[model samples]
Target: MDLIKTEKSIEDTNKTNNQIESIFTSFMENTLFKDKFVLQASYTPETISHREEQIAQIASILAPVLRGERTSNLFVYGKTGTGKTLSVQRVRNELLKRDINSNNLIIEYINCKLKQVSDTEYRIFAELIKKLGGNVPATGLPTGQVYNKFLELIDNEKKLIVIIFDEIDHAVNKITDNFLYNLTRLNTELSKSQISIVGISNNLTFLDEIDPRVRSSLGEEEVVFPPYNALQLQDILNERASRAFMPDVLEEGVISKCSAYAAREHGDARRALDLLRIAGEVAERNGLKKVTLKDIDFANEKIEKDKILEIVTTEPRQFQLVLLSIIDIVEKNERLKDNLSSSIFTGEVYNNYQRLCEKTKNDPLTQRRVSDILSEFDMMGMINSSVISKGRQGRTRQIKLVIPKALVPKVKKILIDAIHLS
Candidate 1:
């Protein structure tokens, strides 16, 4: 009798599994996405909108490589999400399409922010060597040997090579400008091949900080990418929306609102695209047939909250403690009903932070160090710090939380748990 009961249970479980599979398949068939990747930030469209002038300029600079002549090293500068990386990549794609049969050309792209690949001078050289079909271990080799192998590999090929360093500033900050100096100075030593570099950065002032010789060699020509205005952002969103969504899936005014919000925050095209994508996901999750303005608002809030959580979770413990101190002040102000604002002066925050450090059995950082951390938080958009002065009282920074009130409880909980764990 026990065996028979077990057999019946197995039959029921199989039936339930089949039903679950059928439900998932039905949902996939009904999703609003036609080609969802078109709305992704990494997807490069066949035709780029509103960047024709920039593309034409870059193409002209790189055009010399096709005729067996060396191209000038190029520097591209723009704010984040202003299309600097995409335009360069697009130009390179076009060049490769035209040079398909010309094995005499090679193009390599590296993002310096990538972990264990371009983070240091040795790792960057190791990556370049491996890309050229040469063998080099990720570690266990001296820097000089890695450089020699890279040079030898490049010298063997009688081809014109173009190497693009995206976010070159990160590498410079980590390992200094020596790597760039070496690459720029290498052209004279090569006998059989020619090389060019295209450096892309979001920081406009980075060039001024590098060695003058390195700067002159690396920046033969420079191009600046301007941010897209609201109308231009709208046009871009419309183009991608047509390809990404089913007919009439997006309600009226949805794209316009997303574009406007992003434009107000420095005209970031990536932000606009993210808003649209997340809105669609939210609508689909709610089983809605169309994405509406309400969905966009919800997505915006969710994205901001998630960004705050990410910043808080990844920050150093000291930074987290500083944030908690700010939170404690805000809570105290609320309870007192003193009619005074929640914003606290830096000195008071430092005192509270010290007390919290003692409670957690951690040595407190110096006041100057805490002030520096506060400045960093201000730069990161997590908090606002402004300098204020009273007559003969000198000057101090006034700090306030920038995140929404609703998020304070969540942040406080995380900080408490982290403090206990430590």
Candidate 2:
């Protein structure tokens, strides 16, 4: 063996330090390396699993159609992230696995959140007709005609049809269950196909808003999924972690922290998974192989930026602008003695909207139109309103945000950067 050289040892040490620093710098760009391809918060096969009970309930409702038998329409209810959408999709995927399409089975899943833009839920019906290979001729056709075209398409296919409307709350637009009434009419008016509808909603109020007959038809068979318990949430988080991380890389207490946090709040499995995935990303960005419990805790606090961005991306331009104004005005007025009242807030919000337009060179929507945007926020649970006694006005309402006060500044920053950060 050659004799040790002190000068060589120093060179080796410098090289090793450089490699370590390089790894950390790389982590800054790819926070959750393990979850690079995992869709943390989405409704897809890769992101959904372990929903056995809810899946079974959905199966029992849809079994009839798979067996060439007719069944009543089904309505699924639960608070946010109770796996209502995931369960329906799990069942749908299983039904698809049966792969007897030619033997007569058709399934369609639509996000009523998009299709239910107007008072009616006919957009999805038009989509369904296209899926079934029928032309409804989109020349300002009445909803009645669009529905008839849907039936005609299904009749031509001669296959049992299972239509799932995710976010069904959007369909009625506060009172438009006419779609459900006509859908359940298949057993009578549109008898050519065995049509069964599966509706997934986070709002329980939609059920109350529907016509009694439509409610009866929808609830012919119903299932409600409660939020996951701590133990259940742990299992879900652990399972996701296993797929989302390399072996032994996550610290011992990370999943437990994520589970406890989620259970304490809403027991939302989706939220828990999001926190975990975000934490891992954070850890990876820091160039650490192990994700610590502290990392997960930090993720719980920091992930709202991602959620706010998601909301901004999904909304139309004016709605997104209105939301940005709410965040900005609240943040600028954050130091006030009493959080400014809604009236003052609205005026400030309108001004902020105009400034944003000037900055981005985009046109500002009318103030009345902005009020309409507020109505949408109300439905989406992003904000709340309080009815106040305005002397003779007899209880005019004032708007307030329902989002966490802590998230206000962060949301404001994100929206501002989205518009002006070049």
Measured by TM-score, the strongest candidate is 1
lDDT of 1: 0.90
Q: What TM-score does model 2 achieve against the real structure? A: 0.71
Q: If candidate 2 were superposed on the true structure by all CA atoms, what would the RMSD be?
A: 8.1
Give me the runs in candidate 2 sitting further than 4 Å from their true place: 1-39, 42-50, 99-102, 115-120, 136-139, 306-422
Per-model lDDT: 0.90, 0.73
Cα lDDT for residue 259, model 2?
88
* Pairs in steric clash, model 2: 27-285, 28-285, 31-281, 31-285, 32-281
What digit string (tens of lDDT, one per residue) describes model 2 on residues 1-422?
56675998879879989988887778655444555445266535454455677778778878877678776789999888778887788788878788555568888887777633333555667777777777765548887778777667778746777888888887777435666787777757655677778888888777887789988887888888888888888887777777677778878888888888888777888788788777877787677778998898789768765665578666776677788877666655665645544243455667888887877878888988876778778787777755467686454446677777777666666666666643
lDDT of 2: 0.73
TM-score for each candidate, following the candidate numbering: 0.92, 0.71
Tell me the deviation in Å of residue 349 in model 1.
Answer: 1.1
Q: lDDT tens digits, residues 165-184, model 1?
A: 99999989998777899889
lDDT of 1 at 216: 98
For lDDT, the strongest prediction is 1
